[model samples]
Target: METITNRTLNLHEAWFWHEEEDRLRCRLCAHNCLIAPDRSGICRVRKNIDGKLYSLNYGRLIAAHLDPIEKKPFNHFLPGTQSFSIATPGCNLACDWCQNWQISQADEVGSLTRIPEVDPKKVVQAALEFNAASIAYTYTEPVVFYEFARDTALLAREAGLKNIFVTNGLITPEANADLVTWLDAANVDIKAFDQDVYRKYMHGSLEPVLETCKALKAAGIWLEITTLLVPGVNDDPLQLQNLAQFIANDLGTDTPWHISRYYPQYKFDSPPTSLKGIEKAEHLARMAGLRYVYPGNTASSTQTVCPSCGKLLVDRDGYRTVLNELDDGRCPRCNTEIAGNWA
Candidate 1:
């Protein structure tokens, strides 16, 4: 009998294990989903069909928009340029407070049916047409739709466009290797520092995420980290301090960390995170030796300051940027070289 392959199907590369169960265990993320025959993995995108696993949402883009690279929460990379952002449904971890739960938690067939058919080549073309300098795989976990994202990255690179991954960074080493080969920048969310919090709130492991961050750093990808401060959960000072210290030590002090204020969404019905808490997290991150840290989703100015002389370099509000005083990523006041691609 001839085997049938779906044109839209993109089988993943990293999820496999020859365990004693005689079943193909998905090693994509920390879940290690023991997929039964004709069943989908925890991510909902990767499925086991006819004894083979395939990503059902591949090349099916649910959302596409031209956004500011800064909106990807990446402050140090192409500061104010536009980025073509896209996402397919499904996520490895099921967070109760997921912001994009409508899509992330839905069935694969439902999401694929609703989202439009987006060709990989067209995604690259959209970037040029929209005058976007980069393309970001965001809104949902990019690792779940690994094949589409990887293929799109290749086309985007060929078109002289930078590829950014806005992810949870809870992927296997094999997937990371494939992605790092084409990924230019990343904004991985370090949800919480506590292992208990991971198990309870996100239903995930913290170690895999930490390992992924280390791998991204070692791959020399322009890395930034974000932490959503939820009230009465993962908001302890000790946890925040540990998270900041880990980022400073493992990811480097130069990596910009965005401490975002979280709004009550998905399953969580608590109040939104307070401005005070966001400010506090920022202070702790700076105290932990992070050179660049900022608060997001609020009224905060983006002024490039010289760490040495405290001189203002570049000023930004939203996406509008004023190149007031900077030459080759250096502070004009003190002539101190900054760490980023200014050219």
Candidate 2:
């Protein structure tokens, strides 16, 4: 991996910005934070300095690794490829159960500490060197690091590598349209179906996320949805049914829905999601007419079976995939089309 000794880089001018009352209104995400002079947005990374919006976390990577695309929990898109995942140090939403809270919620303003900085070119080079098929802006919200992700994605595309975003699906329509220009695939966390649960636990709304999903689909980006089934939190049957129905009816039945088991983390003290709960959610998703549904963070096998033929197409054991009966992206048994970039 390429590393830089410089602890900080020059601030990047944020996108989707407009002047308001001598301040800057950051329209990058659903939050639409309005920042005054020398103040940061709710994300803690975007700051308004002298009436200009600047992305503080630009090119500052807190985590970088090569992970299986399946770890992104994408069943249909590039099933067995490795993706070079990277993340900056801040996020737009403050989820109490954030799994990567240590890095996502890291505050650098109070302390004199600094995160490692990298150039957008270097990031693309790293992905090429790692022999990764794609570069993933993941582990934290990529929307907060829009400039960095956008630049790297443009370069990566030129380098013949795909770009994916494992995001919260809360980005603004304008920003998402700009992002989809180079983005090839995404695993969007729907979080929950109820707006009240979103506001109470995730400190965000549900509509923007739903809109993002539709926008990505309309933009022709390969999309997958994930919902962390937190025990007694978002595991209600009615809510799960509604979420599944939306994904199937609106996002299309071919969209993959991953029901991930939520473990107690950060501020969330609830018990870990039960195996039975995961199964039930998966069942509901299938019942809602979703073609591909998988249970994550559990012992259940992550196999892709043909919804038409009832035959296994791709058998997966944690990231190790064995393509069994798939003929180029179709089911071998029934010659049914599977919705993914399998080639």
Per-residue lDDT of candidate 1, residues 1-343 (tens digit): 2222454444443344433254468876767788876666788776666666676787778789999887888777887789999998888888889989987787777557556667899999989999999999999999887788888999999999999999999898877887789999999999999999999999898999999999999999888898888988988999999999999998888888888888889899899888899989989998999888878777777676778898877777865665647777888778888776555
Flag regions of model 2 displaced more than 4 Å.
1-9, 110-113
- TM, every model: 0.93, 0.96
Across residues 289-337, which tens digit of lDDT does each residue of candidate 2 receive?
Answer: 9988988888767888888979988998877676656898888889999
Ten consecutive residues with minimal summed lDDT in candidate 1? 1-10
How accurate locally, in lDDT, is each candidate? 0.82, 0.87
Q: Distance (Å) between predicted and true CA of 221, model 1?
A: 0.3
Please identify model 1 stretches exceeding 4 Å from their true place: 1-22
| lDDT of model 2 at position 102 | 90
Best by lDDT: 2
* Candidate 1 root-mean-square deviation in Å: 3.1
